[model samples]
Target: MIKWILILLVVAAVASLLGYHTLAGAAATGARILIGIVLVIFLLVLFGLFAVT
Candidate 1:
Protein backbone atom coordinates (compact mmCIF):
# COMPACT_ATOMS: atom_id res chain seq x y z
CA MET A 1 0.00 0.00 0.00
CA ILE A 2 2.81 2.35 0.87
CA LYS A 3 4.57 1.48 -2.35
CA TRP A 4 1.42 2.19 -4.31
CA ILE A 5 1.14 5.52 -2.61
CA LEU A 6 4.70 6.38 -3.52
CA ILE A 7 4.07 5.50 -7.14
CA LEU A 8 0.96 7.64 -7.19
CA LEU A 9 2.88 10.54 -5.66
CA VAL A 10 5.54 10.34 -8.33
CA VAL A 11 2.96 10.25 -11.08
CA ALA A 12 1.15 13.19 -9.55
CA ALA A 13 4.36 15.18 -9.33
CA VAL A 14 5.13 14.55 -12.97
CA ALA A 15 1.60 15.43 -14.00
CA SER A 16 1.73 18.63 -11.99
CA LEU A 17 5.01 19.65 -13.55
CA LEU A 18 3.72 18.94 -17.01
CA GLY A 19 0.57 20.86 -16.35
CA TYR A 20 2.48 23.82 -15.01
CA HIS A 21 4.86 23.87 -17.97
CA THR A 22 2.03 23.63 -20.43
CA LEU A 23 0.22 26.73 -21.65
CA ALA A 24 -1.95 28.47 -19.12
CA GLY A 25 -5.36 27.20 -20.12
CA ALA A 26 -8.42 25.68 -18.59
CA ALA A 27 -7.35 22.14 -19.47
CA ALA A 28 -3.93 22.52 -17.89
CA THR A 29 -5.32 24.00 -14.71
CA GLY A 30 -7.94 21.28 -14.55
CA ALA A 31 -5.36 18.55 -14.95
CA ARG A 32 -3.17 20.07 -12.25
CA ILE A 33 -6.05 20.29 -9.82
CA LEU A 34 -7.08 16.70 -10.48
CA ILE A 35 -3.58 15.42 -9.95
CA GLY A 36 -3.20 17.45 -6.78
CA ILE A 37 -6.36 15.95 -5.38
CA VAL A 38 -5.21 12.44 -6.26
CA LEU A 39 -1.87 13.05 -4.60
CA VAL A 40 -3.52 14.26 -1.42
CA ILE A 41 -5.83 11.26 -1.29
CA PHE A 42 -2.95 8.87 -1.75
CA LEU A 43 -0.95 10.56 0.96
CA LEU A 44 -3.89 10.29 3.33
CA VAL A 45 -4.24 6.61 2.57
CA LEU A 46 -0.57 6.03 3.19
CA PHE A 47 -0.82 7.75 6.54
CA GLY A 48 -3.86 5.73 7.43
CA LEU A 49 -2.02 2.51 6.66
CA PHE A 50 0.87 3.57 8.86
CA ALA A 51 -1.42 4.46 11.70
CA VAL A 52 -3.27 1.16 11.51
CA THR A 53 -0.05 -0.80 11.51
Candidate 2:
Protein backbone atom coordinates (compact mmCIF):
# COMPACT_ATOMS: atom_id res chain seq x y z
CA MET A 1 0.00 0.00 0.00
CA ILE A 2 2.78 2.36 0.87
CA LYS A 3 4.47 1.43 -2.37
CA TRP A 4 1.28 2.18 -4.25
CA ILE A 5 0.99 5.57 -2.61
CA LEU A 6 4.56 6.42 -3.60
CA ILE A 7 3.91 5.26 -7.14
CA LEU A 8 0.78 7.36 -7.39
CA LEU A 9 2.53 10.41 -6.01
CA VAL A 10 5.34 10.06 -8.53
CA VAL A 11 2.81 9.67 -11.34
CA ALA A 12 0.99 12.76 -10.19
CA ALA A 13 4.17 14.79 -10.08
CA VAL A 14 5.26 13.69 -13.52
CA ALA A 15 1.83 14.26 -14.97
CA SER A 16 1.62 17.73 -13.52
CA LEU A 17 5.05 18.58 -14.86
CA LEU A 18 3.97 17.38 -18.28
CA GLY A 19 0.74 19.47 -18.11
CA TYR A 20 -1.59 16.50 -17.86
CA HIS A 21 -3.78 18.20 -15.30
CA THR A 22 -6.56 15.61 -15.40
CA LEU A 23 -4.28 12.66 -14.96
CA ALA A 24 -2.34 14.40 -12.22
CA GLY A 25 -5.53 15.21 -10.36
CA ALA A 26 -6.74 11.62 -10.57
CA ALA A 27 -3.46 10.23 -9.35
CA ALA A 28 -3.31 12.72 -6.50
CA THR A 29 -6.83 11.80 -5.47
CA GLY A 30 -5.96 8.12 -5.45
CA ALA A 31 -2.88 8.80 -3.32
CA ARG A 32 -4.98 10.78 -0.85
CA ILE A 33 -7.52 7.97 -0.54
CA LEU A 34 -4.82 5.39 0.10
CA ILE A 35 -3.19 7.61 2.71
CA GLY A 36 -6.51 8.04 4.45
CA ILE A 37 -7.07 4.30 4.53
CA VAL A 38 -3.60 3.70 5.94
CA LEU A 39 -4.12 6.35 8.58
CA VAL A 40 -7.43 4.85 9.68
CA ILE A 41 -5.94 1.41 9.96
CA PHE A 42 -3.01 2.75 11.94
CA LEU A 43 -5.32 4.54 14.34
CA LEU A 44 -7.46 1.46 14.85
CA VAL A 45 -4.42 -0.63 15.65
CA LEU A 46 -3.04 2.02 17.97
CA PHE A 47 -6.29 2.05 19.95
CA GLY A 48 -6.39 -1.71 20.13
CA LEU A 49 -9.57 -1.87 18.09
CA PHE A 50 -7.84 -3.92 15.38
CA ALA A 51 -5.94 -7.12 15.92
CA VAL A 52 -2.94 -7.89 13.80
CA THR A 53 -3.24 -11.61 14.56
Candidate 3:
Protein backbone atom coordinates (compact mmCIF):
# COMPACT_ATOMS: atom_id res chain seq x y z
CA MET A 1 0.00 0.00 0.00
CA ILE A 2 2.86 2.35 0.81
CA LYS A 3 4.44 1.38 -2.47
CA TRP A 4 1.22 2.23 -4.25
CA ILE A 5 1.13 5.63 -2.55
CA LEU A 6 4.69 6.32 -3.64
CA ILE A 7 3.84 5.27 -7.18
CA LEU A 8 0.87 7.59 -7.24
CA LEU A 9 2.95 10.46 -5.91
CA VAL A 10 5.52 9.91 -8.63
CA VAL A 11 2.80 9.72 -11.24
CA ALA A 12 1.32 12.97 -9.91
CA ALA A 13 4.68 14.69 -10.13
CA VAL A 14 5.22 13.54 -13.65
CA ALA A 15 1.73 14.48 -14.69
CA SER A 16 2.11 17.92 -13.20
CA LEU A 17 5.40 18.41 -14.99
CA LEU A 18 3.71 17.48 -18.25
CA GLY A 19 0.88 19.94 -17.53
CA TYR A 20 -1.80 17.28 -17.07
CA HIS A 21 -3.41 19.14 -14.20
CA THR A 22 -6.43 16.90 -13.96
CA LEU A 23 -4.42 13.72 -13.95
CA ALA A 24 -2.02 15.11 -11.40
CA GLY A 25 -4.85 16.24 -9.17
CA ALA A 26 -6.45 12.82 -9.36
CA ALA A 27 -3.24 11.05 -8.49
CA ALA A 28 -2.57 13.43 -5.65
CA THR A 29 -6.03 12.81 -4.27
CA GLY A 30 -5.49 9.08 -4.47
CA ALA A 31 -2.19 9.39 -2.61
CA ARG A 32 -3.81 11.48 0.10
CA ILE A 33 -6.62 9.00 0.54
CA LEU A 34 -4.23 6.06 0.75
CA ILE A 35 -2.08 7.86 3.27
CA GLY A 36 -5.09 8.67 5.42
CA ILE A 37 -6.26 5.08 5.36
CA VAL A 38 -2.81 3.83 6.26
CA LEU A 39 -2.57 6.27 9.13
CA VAL A 40 -5.91 5.20 10.53
CA ILE A 41 -4.94 1.57 10.34
CA PHE A 42 -1.65 2.25 11.98
CA LEU A 43 -3.37 4.04 14.82
CA LEU A 44 -5.76 1.17 15.29
CA VAL A 45 -2.90 -1.30 15.45
CA LEU A 46 -1.06 0.87 17.92
CA PHE A 47 -4.08 0.93 20.17
CA GLY A 48 -4.32 -2.88 20.03
CA LEU A 49 -7.57 -2.75 18.16
CA PHE A 50 -6.05 -4.64 15.23
CA ALA A 51 -3.76 -6.99 17.06
CA VAL A 52 -2.31 -9.98 15.19
CA THR A 53 -2.81 -13.14 17.15
Clashing pairs in 3: none
Q: Comparing candidate 1 with candidate 3, which one achieves the higher lDDT?
A: 3
lDDT of 2 at 20: 100
Writing each residue's lDDT as its tens digit, candidate 2 over 1-53 gives 99999999999999999999999999999999999999999998887854654
| lDDT: worst 10-residue window of model 3 | 44-53
Residue-level lDDT of model 1, residues 2-53, one tens digit each, is 4544555565567667774343344445556667777899999999999999
RMSD for all candidates, in order, please: 7.7, 3.0, 2.7
Off by over 4 Å in 1: 1-24
User: Against the unseen true structure, what C-alpha lDDT does each candidate score?
Assistant: 0.63, 0.96, 0.97
What is candidate 1's local distance difference test score? Answer: 0.63
